[model samples]
Structure formats: structure tokens, C-alpha cells
Target: MHPPRANRAYRNVARVLRPVLYAITRRDWRGTEHLPVGSGFIAAGNHMTNVDPITFAHYLYDNGVAPKILAKSSLFSVPVLGWVLRTSGQIPVHRNTSQAGDSLRAAEQALAAGECVAVFPEGTLTRDPDLWPMVAKTGVARLALTTRVPVVPIAQWGPQLLLGRYAKVFKPIPPKRVTVVAGPPVDLADLYGRPLDAATLREATARVMAAITALLADVRGETPPERPYDMRRGGGGAGADGPAAPTADGAA
Candidate 1:
């Protein structure tokens, strides 16, 4: 499923961009050992900002694993970016219900071919004001169960600070340290013998998000906001909620 010339060109571009990105942010990553050394695995992460994918890709490339992302279909309609994405074999997913199956099929094929596919189980960027991850979708679980592939949970922070989630601006703030943490592989062996039901998928999604949240807590060193967006009644900000709720991974 390699894209020939497109992939080669992308590699060249990535090589050039990697150094510049590193220099600009002085980015630091941890937990590279947790990433599967080879292919046939799904990299699931919480979606916070648009730049999160690029950060993930750069981290994987630095660790010697090339990642193919399942991106929104609208991104493929861009000018040069679309060409690069198509040639580089990135999957485009249509959010519409009718075309959702196509996206899943593409993911299945990519995994079947022993390639690494990165997916954002959160579906959309987190609208949470305090930056805690939102409730995630079940797509990643569906893919993992159907393909029986290892799910590597990735947690990233600092990218949102670079390009504020709502600001659409890249601030030149100095040394805004970004961290990419990859957790150990999540095994769903117990569910292998059963069908992929809603309950199982939801459980897997929770586990994936919990892993990411733990890594994020490690990176930020602050408790995540209890509720997604810390929403409160009467459209007010996050009230003095109790301590952050425990994630499925048991991290507070």
C-alpha cells in the first residue's frame, strides 16, 4: 500500500521539516520503547489540536516507525497538502454516515498490509476549555477488534500551547516544551473470542483514552479538568468540582 514517488517525496520533506520542528519547539519525547517496533498495530491518541497529528508523526518517525494517519476527508481536498497526503498513503475518512464504512475499510486494509495506522478516537478536537480529553468515539476499538491488532496509546501535550486550540495562531513563545508519550500496548485478547459489541467497543475506547490521559498528566504535571470542557450548568465555567475523576487506567 505504499505510494511510491509520493512516499519518497514525503520522506524528503519530513526529513527537512523534522529538524526545523525540533529546533522551533525544542520538543522532547518519552516512552519511545512503548511503541511497537514494527507494524500491524493501531496508534490511538486523544485529539486536542490540529497540530497533534504532525507531532505524533514526527515522534514515530524519530523512533523509526512511519505512521499513516486516518484524516478527515475534507483535508484531502486542499491543494498541495492533498497531493502530499494522497501520495504518502494517508487514509481519508468521510464523516458522513454513508461513507463511514469506506473509511473503516481503508483502515482494515492498511492494518492487513502490516502498516501502522494512527487514529484519533476522540473523533474531533477537544473543545474542553481546560484541555482534558473529551469522550471518545468507538472507531479505534472497532478497528482493533476486527483486525486483532495491538493498540498503542499515545499521549501528547504542549502542541496545544504552541498553536492554541481556539486561537488558530502559532505563538513564538520560548521553549514551550512538548511531550509525546507512548504507553505500552493494550491487549484485547479476552474479546477475541467474542463479537465486537457496543459494550466491548466502549470499554476499549475508555482504556485507550485513559492511557492517553495518564501520559498527559505526566507531561503537564497538573490534574485534568474533571469534565470534558469542564462544562457547568447555566453556561458557567468549571465549578469547584471535586478532584479529577479517575480514568479507566486509574490515573487521577
Candidate 2:
């Protein structure tokens, strides 16, 4: 199915931010060949810095896909920026609230409508001091399993260099080098048609995180730890984890 056409509000925002990003960040984007054109799919990326959404969106926009991002609820209340985000078809996530599920429902609807939905499964910036992707929420897995759409694993490096994690200072002077790589859709066929229990969700989320970590490893040229960092436990290893290799074409 063909995704919905890009709205003018998004185009206008892109027009304004694209040149700024182009002027400041030296992009080393790869894996555009894995993006599913003309169809709805989830782009699950690692969360590094606050500026990541901008760079991630820029990459998608330049690739001819205007993403419907699942952004934090607070961002939606930030004066004029909120209005622009709402008008541009961005979904607001109300974390740790009764309304948290609202974003997931909205994301499902966006997928059904054939709109590309970008998600940061980690939900927040990595607590892993090294900026490696930490254990992520299971929302991306739930969305992929329920919607049965491709969940393309995307890893981004260097946004934290431009603007440090949770830091307010923006350093655009040196023109930081940002690398964004998109791996093929994760293979979840074995997990599909199964019950959506906690075990199932964890397995699926693990796969998503593993694929993202591998891509980031390739970009950074370093082997990842045996396990992803589990934020709940405040640690550096979630053993029993393995890489989720991409599936054959047309297999979700």
C-alpha cells in the first residue's frame, strides 16, 4: 500500500530544518536501500541525544519519506513548536501516564493508514554512559507484531557529539560527523501469530535492539557487549541476547 502523501506543514518544517542540518552536520548516512518505499513501516532507532529526532527526520525526509514521529508529550506543549508538530502529523507519547497507550493506538492507526512511523524504542536517551543503545520498551515490538509491518532497525551515531545527551548546549561550530545506518527489516516471522505475553514481547524487543546495536557497532567499528544495558537494573549487561539478522526480502 502507498503511504499517505507528505503534508505541507511537514514540508515547511523540513524546508526550514534541512538547510540548517546540512550546514551544520556532516552526514554519513547508509542503508537507504532497506527503506520500504510507498508502504507503511516502522523505523525503530536508537535514542542518543535530543537532536536525534531532527537528524533522523532529516534523513527520512531527504529519502522521500516524511515520517510520522512518536515524540514526547512535553514537546507537544512547547509553544509554537507544539502546534507545528501537531499540524505536521507527529504523534505525542505520554510516558508513565494513563494516556501513554494513546500514542501506541495512534501509531497503529498511522501504520494502517500507510504512513511511515518513526519510533525511538528506548523512549529516552541512553543511560549507558557510552551512548550505546540501552534496553528499550516493548512498544515497537507490539506495534510490529500487531501491525505485521516491517520494523527497520536504524542506528545513529554522532548526534550526541553535536549536542551531548540531555545537555542544553548546542555545538554547531565544528560541524560534527553524524552517521545514520538502516538495516533490513528484522525477522519476526517465528514470533508472529503467538500470544502477546511478556516473554514474547521481551524476545521481540530484544531482536529489535540487537539489530540496532549491530548497526551501531558497524558504524562505530566496535563490538557490542554481550548484553544490552537494562535501565531498570542500572547495569551494562542483559545476557542471553543475540543479533537479529535481517530476513529475506518481502518477509516481515
Candidate 1 deviant stretches above 4 angstroms: 1-6, 78-84, 172-175, 225-252
Top candidate on TM-score is 2
In model 2, the worst 10-residue window by lDDT is 243-252
lDDT string for model 2 (24-48, tens) is: 9999889999999778899989988
Q: Tens digit of lDDT per residue, candidate 1, span 100-125?
A: 56767777887787777888776667
Q: lDDT of candidate 2 vs native?
A: 0.78
Clashes of 2: 0
TM, every model: 0.82, 0.89
